[model samples]
Target: MPETLRKTFAKWHHWIGVFCASLLAIFCLTGGLCTIGPAFDHWVSPLPPSISKVFHTPSAESVAVATEYMEQTRGEAPAFLRLPTPQDPVFRLIRYDGNAFQTILSLHPETGLPFKDKPSLETGFFIALHSTLYLNRKVIDFIGLFVSLAGLGAVISGILIHWKRLKSDFQLLRLFSPTPRRALDFHLFCTLIALPFLLTALVTGVWIESQHLVEDFSPRPVISVTETESQKNLPAHLPPEAYKELYQAGAHYWGKDNQGFFLIAPHQALLVPSDGKSISLTRPHLALTQIGVKSWNIAPSTDKNISLTAFVKGLHLMRWATGEMRWVVSLSAVLLWAALGAGSFLLLMKQRSALNRRNACPSRSDKIAFSFAESFALSAFGLLPLTLLGLLWLEWLSPKIPLSLSIHAPQGRVDAFFCVWIGLSLIGLAFSLFRWVGSFPFADKALRLLWKITLKGSVFFALALPFITLLGREWRHLPLLPNTASLLLEGHFVLFGLILFMCIRKNT
Candidate 1:
């Protein structure tokens, strides 16, 4: 390596790491948590009814059901019924009085009763916390953008630092090092090995968060459609059953045309002359035969909304790539946390050695302080996996619990799961503290082997996650054996842990 360039790059890497470590840590933790997002939805909602109980109606029928329910409950018709799709459990009915859009939910098929119960907080809570730390939204967005950019810098600098040793250090973890060197090795190994996932995550993170910028720059047309006498004379808000009426009208308008989904916005005119279709708040799921209304003639018939771009984006982010993929990401995150802790410890040990040499005999307080810091890091590293495992165990146990009569969803099992998981996390965290009690050193040989094995296992599981989902014949349906794939990977984890135990058994 050239002296000047090497020195310059080293300086940059060092400073950047120092500056961004805290933020990097937060991003790492959040990204890791998001690995379980897909599974979260399963817990958030009531267990779906038996497949046989679910009614598969034409899109038009969905509209009719929504409208009928609205008329009975609200005593007025809604100008809009956002089309029903498989994704949302409830259909949204919209009324545009003179000023604003009011929304109500039709609880069941042909039951326009407004959802009297409190809405589930899970969806909103995750979204709010994920984007902002529940702080100001704009500030959080800016901070997210900053974190993403910093991640970019860290990755670039990190790669440079490990450029030469990159291949050789792929399996790097010194067996018998003081803390600092060990920590460096651990850090290098993690960054070097998990580079691709981290990079993709970082880039995608920034892009996803910056969507508002595109909206700001894009051009939108002004809506200018003359309402028909019937539309003008129509009450400011249509009856609650407007959706059902619209759907029935549309069903008759387009015979046997079973478009999916609906959207209702009554305040806006039902036509956009600039675009070919009328102003429809709803759309169809069918790719080839999807219809978008450019205009709605209130005098003649009802209209179904159409637009293609929205679904494509929704599919990408939801990542319903199957349960196995979720498991892979979750496991990778677990490994990443381990790597971080292990590597950081190695680095700290190296530093401690230097301190010891400089002082010849360091004071007791300094040692205690150093020990406390190490314990904190290790706590973070250990707590995450324990928490995750607890959650999984909860999911496994949830089916046995009874349901809530007042709530639309099953409540007992999920509640129990959280309580037990959180409790176990606290307990496991206390137990893991034993690892930090000693200034003792372990033989590096087994630790080294363990790291390699875990790394390989993580990669194997990650690749396996997506492929298994894709290969399944009924990807959309529940797998007959939910436990099968996870159990195999878990067995691998147990075996890996056992192997590590044999390797480091004497050291502890």
Candidate 2:
């Protein structure tokens, strides 16, 4: 690369990384958690232990049970039935109340009795945060699309800037080297290691968003329903027996090795089977109506274009992953975020070093901009873990507090997360302003003190999380076993907190 071209790429890479670091970090952490979203749901709200053996209830029966349970409890039938699997042998009925909240009901397969009923907030929160940044769907889609594109741009520019050094950069890490060189080496090492995974994720994210945008604006085909002899003979709604027949027909058409059928419409059902030996994870479906099995929709053609698209989507989403492969993907996401963070931090540090090397004082605007950037970075990095710890603490504390002072269930807890995050960011900004306005000789010390306090506070809360949860009244209700999600989360908090503390202590 020419000197000017190299500088341009480097400049764009640094700028994009700096601008999108916080959003990308949020995406990475939430996306990692969401990769195991089902596990989280199982851990947080497992099936009743009394149901010892899995019951093989027919799909239609399960849906009927779920529908009856929902109608009895919420005075309305569920909008959709998520059929039971062997792994999670409960009929899940989803009901939207035409507002921000939605209700989810899980019923026993055999008994047709309610196992759990709650707002669809807990597991959905992570997914919503990952997909839409907890904003309006339309607005966040655009923002997410832009951020994903910028992330891809950053990755490409970074590769261009480091094209020559790419071969040698992965050789070794020099911890004892000068700060700038060491930071650069560490950043490059992580970037190179996570390059392939990061590139696939970014590219697929862009593709997914583009498809969503297109679908959002595209015109839908209008299908006119003519009153044919078959349509006239069919009843308005299929009876329960008809559901059973439809399920049998659909199952037979798809073979025994299928997931389950979902009621897509009043009289129509769509059956989905497990992934097969192809790049496409999209399952073939058997569509049924009141009459009988209407059509067998085969899987999409395995052409080069379709296969490539499917491969990219499956790779990015890991929809076909199971067991330990999900964990690998989650860890890869975390490492990719680490790479981005390191790159952004190194850029900021290099800028600070350059400023320090210049004997002349920086302009007032430059000082303000630098201070703001530092504050934003500090809050962005610190608030995520702090918010998570805050939510855990709230979970334990909410029940104990008086009704007047208590935060309500899931929604209030989510609100508390945002409150804590915003509060912490404000505090960080205040400290940054103080550091900037304070006496020259003490400014650096003040800033360092701010970071040390933030780090120590975060570590304190992270360490306190497990004990608080265990000793609280809800301990008996929570799953705290070694393999459960509670213990896994607690271990993460302690391990990551200590690592963060040690790193900060050493560097600061």
Candidate 3:
């Protein structure tokens, strides 16, 4: 690069780094947590004592029986029936109220009825917030876009800063040195080792968040069908059972293996069996087919938009990835958070030095920004792991807590999350005020106190897993793998907290 261009790039990197440091940290931690989204999901879902039998292709009637049972129990018609999958032993009846969708379980295929147990509320809510930030579409899209761009900025600047020192810094540590330079070296070293994982996560995250943008750029094709004269004479409102019969008749056209995935319109249903042709048609088109319709007219027309969205969403979240590939993604998440913390500390140390050399403190605005960032980084991130445990605790103890898609059950566990989180925040606040009033060094006293508290909290939350699984009635049937995963993750947090404490200086 030219010297002038290099200098311009360097300046751009520095100021932008400073500008987005706190927000970038928030992004990194949240994104990292999302990377382990599936594992977190498993932690809170109900784990039956025994695994259920897996069927390759269960009969349509068997599915219908289960569907009918769930509807009767809920006292509302079921919108759809999901096939039993390996992860979810019981078949789910997806229904809708005025507000949100709800899933009711079918105990077994042969016996069509709602399961006695309730759905896992805590897991579902966290998963929703993790994926969508519990917001409307436009807001979520903007958040996704901003966070992605910020991460991109960090990666670009981080690479430039570490390009030369990458290899030599791998061995750098600060067991002896207490200088700011030593801290910088340690931060840079971990970040360099984790660079590839960090970049991959950012790129994937951007792709996931920019899905709507992609759709906007390439809109789905429109499908239009003309109504036949015979169909034009039909009543405006069709019978409710009309959909069900039309679906079965259409399945016959495709042959024995053909099964209905979901219903679309009055005369239309999407069928994709193991061995059958898939097509969409109006009532007239279905009439022409070889399958004899017992009663009501039918139609099937395909919409390309729904399929495209499912495919893109699955890819963005790595839903199809199995086993080891999933682990790779989780590891990337850890690296992402590690990089964020290191990057933020680097920016803070640099600013602190500049102030000391000038014999001046940071301006009020700068100090406020710094404090806000620290508070969020400490409390908000801490809330995440804590909230996760609280959620799992609810799952183990309260299998009967009812949560509908639209219905907000008592939200007992959610209330507990806020209680614990707010309590921690208040304690941190009191400590911060104590330092301020005592005229004690804010950096040393306040920071160290926060660090120690965070470490203890993280350890307790993580360590509680074994006992939670063994002692809790609902969790007794759960497997060993989840417990092991919890321990490993807790160990990582414990190490991270200790490192932060040791790196603390006389000043904050």
Candidate 4:
């Protein structure tokens, strides 16, 4: 590349990183956490030790039990039912509990009663953070759209800047080298390693956000409900027996493939097929009445378009990915997080070095901008993981804490997280400003001390989480295998702790 073009690309890359670094890190970390949703769900709400094996209950029977239980407890029928699979044999019914919030109730397959307590708060918290960033759906979609676009630009520009050295430097890493060189190499290595997956995620994310545009531009499909002779003579409502028979018929038709069936309405049901299949989100239903069973097969789109869309979505979301593939995707997300951090670090450090080399007192504006940049970098790299670990600790300790003390378990976890994060941000800002006003070396030492303290505290909490859980609960209540939540938490702590340790060790 020419000198001018290279410099332009480099500038764009650095500014893009500076602009979207925090958001990118948030997305990557949450995306990785979301990939282990099922495992987290299991950890949060494990089966009772009393139930050694799941009972094989009939679908209609389970639905009836869940309905009765919901009506008795919540005074309303559930809006949706998540049918039990072999892996998770408890039926989950979700109801809109007035205020537009949905409450999920898990019921035993045999007795139809709720389990010992509510579902795991940790599971719901992480999921909420991942999906919407705790904001409205449309707002999140808007933010995601812009973030993904900027990310795409960053990735493209980065590749362009590194194209000449791409082959030779792709796998090069010098752990023992100087901090700047090592940081650059590691950043490039991680980016190259996760490029394909990251690109797929970014492109599909953009496509998903632009789906509203597609809907507006595309012609809507017309549907004609033709009444058969039997349907024309049918009663408005089917008897309970007839409904059961209809369910059996639907199960025979689609459930034969071991697909789960969810009750969409009193007389309508939808099938949840195995992952990787191209099926309409709202189609492939069996509608039943007094007359007969009517099956609807409205395609999401024409065969080719829907198939392609579904495939791309599956790749992005990892919905169809197996266990090992999900792990690979999670690892890719981690690498993306590391790459973003390293890139931002390299940019900020290089800028600081440049400013120092000028050998003159910097202006007020320069000092302010550099301070803001340093604080942002510090929050992204340090505060995020610390806040995450703090939340986990809160989740574990909430139950033990007294309600009169002004903290609510599970429900207050999110609030506490924000409180801790804001607190840390304020402290970091103070340190940055302190560094700005004081001598360079003294301020640097103070900042490094703060960083080391924060890192060590995070490490201590992360490493202590599993033992806390084990000791907090009775031995019988513990999982037979290592809980996925604990394992994931520990893995993240170790990975992040190692990175922080390296930074401290290298005096960077």
Q: CA lDDT, every prediction?
A: 0.43, 0.62, 0.50, 0.64
Q: Against the hidden reference, what TM-scores do the models get?
A: 0.49, 0.78, 0.65, 0.78
Clashes of each: 41, 0, 6, 0
**lDDT tens per residue, model 1, 1-508:** 6778777776555444433443444445445445454234333222223322233443444445455544443433335444433333344554543322334343443343344422232322333334565455556667766766776776686677678887776565673465455456656655555666566666766775566445545686654555343234334344434444445554554433332334323322231111112223222221111122322234332334343333332332324333456565555544454454554444445545655585477566655555444434433433333333433333333333344542223233335434644454444334333333454234233333433443343334433433443334143244444334334444534543442233222323
Evaluate residue 447 in candidate 1 and report its C-alpha lDDT on the 0 to 100 scale.
36
lDDT against true structure, model 2: 0.62
lDDT (Cα) of model 4 = 0.64
Candidate 1 matches the true fold with a TM-score of: 0.49
Q: Please provide, for model 3 over 100-156, each residue's C-alpha lDDT reduced to its tens digit, 9 standing for 90 to 100.
A: 334544356444445455555523444445555546766766676766677677568
Worst 10 residues of 4 by lDDT: 295-304
Query: What lDDT tens digits, residue by residue, belong to model 2 across residues 361-406?
Result: 7777866766777766676566676676666566556545556643
Query: Which residue pairs show backbone clashes in model 2?
Result: none
Model 2 Cα shift for residue 137 (angstroms): 3.3
**How does model 3 score by TM-score?**
0.65
TM-score of 2: 0.78
Off by over 4 Å in 1: 2-39, 43-49, 52-59, 63-125, 171-194, 204-345, 356-380, 384-508
